[model samples]
Target: MSPHDQHETPGIDLARLRPWFAEAVPQARAEALSATLITGGKSNLTYRLSDGGSSWILRRPPLGHVLATAHDMGREYAVMAALADLHAVDPDAVGLGGFGRPQSFLTRQVARWRKQLAASYTRDLPDAVTLHAALEERATAADAASRPGIVHGDFRLDNVLVDGDDRLRAVIDWEMATVGDPVTDLALMLLYTRLARLVGPEIAPTPPTSSARRRSSPGTRPAAAATSATWASTWASRPSSSPRSSRASTSATWADRPSAPASTASVAERSTWTWATVSSPKGGGQWVGPGQDRVLALIEEVGLSTFKTYVDGKSIYLRGGKRQTFAGAVPPMKPSALADFQRLAVKLEEMASTVPLDAPWSAPRAVEWDSTTFGQWLDANAATDEAKWLFTLAFTVIQGEDPHLSSLLLILFHIAGCGGIEHMISTTGGSQESRVVGGTQRISQEPAKRLGKRVVLSSPVTEIRRQDRGVLVKSERVTVRCKRVIVAMSPADAGRIRFTPHLPVRRATLQRRWHNGTESKLFAVYDKPFWRDAGFSGSAMTDLPVARFVVDNSPPDGSVGILLTFMGTAGSGPGLTWSDAVLDDPRARRDALLADLTKLFGPKAAHPVRHLEQDWAREPWISGRVSTRPPGLMTQYTDAVSRPVGRIHWAGTETATVYDGYLEGAVRAGERVAKEVGAAL
Candidate 1:
């Protein structure tokens, strides 16, 4: 019998457990009580209970036998209680709520559920065995050290709840909580997350290893026996005993092999919910739904051949021709992959490029602002001097030739007035005037330095043939081999550059999506610093465009100046190409911006001396904007991006940790790449 098929055994009753709760928690009588079982997970049974208006959760060992160290309810309660105390004071710390002592009645009830699950398994699942073995080995190998407080042994997502506001309301399930190694608790949490994705949310109790069971003597307490019995029952209910058809057995056998391809079809057919396949080329076949021609056409359009050798779901196929699985891991593609895709996507983009770029055309939206409240908000959120310095570096380079120098000076003056420079000097014990002057000089020098360095800029590099001592940078230019080559470019560029011996997909993916910042930088220059005279600082009033932000750069000299604006929308790339001619024409659609600024400030703001702008789209040497990240790409590819490929190392704004999109990011990238290159030597 499969664990799912096993008959449920009667265990302890909730009514019996209620007395313990009532006695232990004096507040229970005043609270309304309700109980519901949350299914999934082997070894422990978890329940959610509400007392009066307050919600609480309970957890206990599954019915029958369990491993001795597996489910220690006492430890879980202790840890949560300790953490709660800390959480009350420090909201940033990882802490959960109130805890209670173990209840014998609850323990018996959980044991019964475990027994049912263990007994239900009619056939053995080799995959389950392998996974258990891996977990046990990892646990044993980890250092046996005490952590801060109690560890939640089975800390899976279901055991945790988020309220309507998306705050983690509570963490329940104490059966596996312990005072041993905190790493073990972390491991268990990770294990549960994996198991939840593999099995349904309701987990079947796992049988303990023979060594674990033998270690538990007859003198074991009821709790220990309950845990052991659950494990034993689960082990006894393997699926191999079932009289499965040859086809069913074959399918099971294939599934048991970790390397075997999961069905790349719809949930209706395979009954699997995996985002990996959904985003993959193999999964693409299922999306076309029997339309082979359409599937083939889509494949051709996407250039599936380029992705055949990649892995981690970004690549279409992996070794052994299996569709890469990205579920529960990072998403399939890296930022670099997207960059490469964008490169390929350009061909398609060009066909549509002729179409007029769309912009919202209407009178500027009105925003009500309370001056006092707005001032307080600024004081609260204003970047520190360090942050401002970093921001200045970042924003300056993107400002290019037509930066609003006067506006920058005014901003600096405002900063000085706000005691920003003074604070910086006091913190660092440096000369305030010198620091300000130095910072200003650095900002002024950045744009010219970036544009001054002229190199043979290449795009879509065909190959980077490597010799023993040097690497050849092959583009449209004749191959130039050097003792070393610094591939301070995008990951897509690095990936396309072929090594003498081809680099691994891991290395290639690292290069391509190394620093995946798809952010947008927009510049809107004004005729003069009219806003300042009107009592409005250059800063704007919104947070739309996600990262949409504006800075006032009206020249201090009262000359024509510019306001640099950044719109952080993924689709906002086309806006970079907005030229002076486009904005200058009285009949052009954007002419109203001039009118709006004039009305908002004064007539002098009607036309900018020169309205210069750039969207990351037009930047060829640097693809995309600074390295803003999506959810999972950063953690997944961090190490890979850091690694060097052959004699070729990479340095780009995206590679920098300190100032990723800023000039600081560039400097950091340079330093890191230099270190890697030096290390290789």
Candidate 2:
């Protein structure tokens, strides 16, 4: 095939590799070397090269057409090499004991990420790609750097690991690592922390409680103070390079981090909470979803150039299939929509500058600010009463209350710059349909296998009985005794646990008040993508009574058409609906949904061969899909939401700082708590 026609880059062969490794590190460990590819990375290729026992990961640029800013394997290797030794005496980053200037680190990463996304657009998610292309243009990068230090370009929990004692085991996948601004590493970590919270613990195997990252976090702990005894002796011997440019070694560090509880939980409380084993619904008859023209038209009509200003009316953003936060920024103002969006940016930046993520509620700006909800915040800033659609689509709509209350911090963190923020993170955001080739099991099975543990399915946790020593986690199939436990499931499901000492007043309040917004996804499968032929991008968003967000999740080859759509918000929307009563009659539900889709995509949308239904609220272990904050609740209890109590640490997308209701939040929460738990342990 012509190279231009090729979608992916050619895979490297061992015949070409043996010589390269021999030349790169002649001291050699290549006796009968073999290479196996690693899966799950978004834009690069990774392989595990092993000679009998030990394994080292090898990474390269993406196989298909790649953007100039997309990958730099040399930079990654240089960072790791600077940290680790040449099999002799080298200094490792984990050995440094602490980090320096994290705020500056975050600002730089955003700038770099924006650059990468501007030039690259993949085939699967054209809609998100287009919005992002425009979003990047309006961004104003944070200018908070002190001095340059070693920066790990893509510093995330998944890329790093820890030992049993919670020390940095290795900072792998250095392809993106570079020395310029070390603080960017911390910034990226914080950004990842925010994004991961949307998806539960974003990192796998690595607990959210790891100490290495905690040190990197700005407010959590002090950095560059603690010194590992062996630092000077080993690092002094290395060839000279800039402190920020040259890498540090990884083999030895002080190992001075704190420890966790000693005794494990009781045997009885260690039973199974059957969450990971919900079986897939069976049916030769297809489960239909939706083809989203409403959302796409919203994006196209709004035009990313000034979507944030509310000039084009409504804006729709989608990855291959997931929805990030959607809506307007400031309410409409007289001076011009573009000017208002720019003003909105200034307001958010002020909030970001003034309101600390750690104590947003107590921040003087919020304390003295007279706004109760986001609607009020907008109105105070000049949005009219009828311009309530921004809050209506983004946050929940509560009855009796005008302008719907919401957490100001949540708004600042999520929708502050709108397209500007999206442009910064879009490279990693999106459906990533190409990577999901592994399916759901990829999240748990792969991690379990690497850690030498088996994924025991079927059994669900019935109760978590707290003991003097630890907690007992029990399920119908098995019981586990552990010193500490990370409740990684949704708050709703976690509340079901029977805590022996019971949760604290704040935690109990959070458990009592937190509720998942009711959401339903239905798919209409057809023989072809009928809408695509009609100049449609298959994405849509609306104020329609029932279904709102819509998109097309068709196969790459287009064997069959898939139109995915969403409906139902807690305490809102038409209840004339498809909850359980129509479970038996899929057609009835399909027809009802089709009426709405037909309105957006013409009468053709009403005809589908089959329908697919996914009730995220009813998922076995996870009781809900999206965490919805109604008016006044989120800000009141935000503090106690993710904090650890004794040996029990809490995580879930709800606990994340950014995109709290998305998959990214989940990953972030998991990684953060994993580090916390790891260090304590």
Q: What value does the lDDT take at residue 340 in candidate 2?
A: 55
Candidate 2 residues lying further than 4 Å off, grouped into runs, are 1-353, 367-371, 375-387, 394-406, 416-435, 438-441, 448-453, 570-589, 630-638
TM-scores, in order shown? 0.32, 0.46
lDDT of 2 at 675: 82
Q: For every candidate structure, what is the RMSD over all alpha carbons to the true structure, in angstroms?
A: 26.6, 24.9
Report lDDT (Cα) of residue 487, candidate 1: 58
* Tens-digit per-residue lDDT, 600-658, candidate 2: 67788877776666655444344454554544455566578778877777776667664
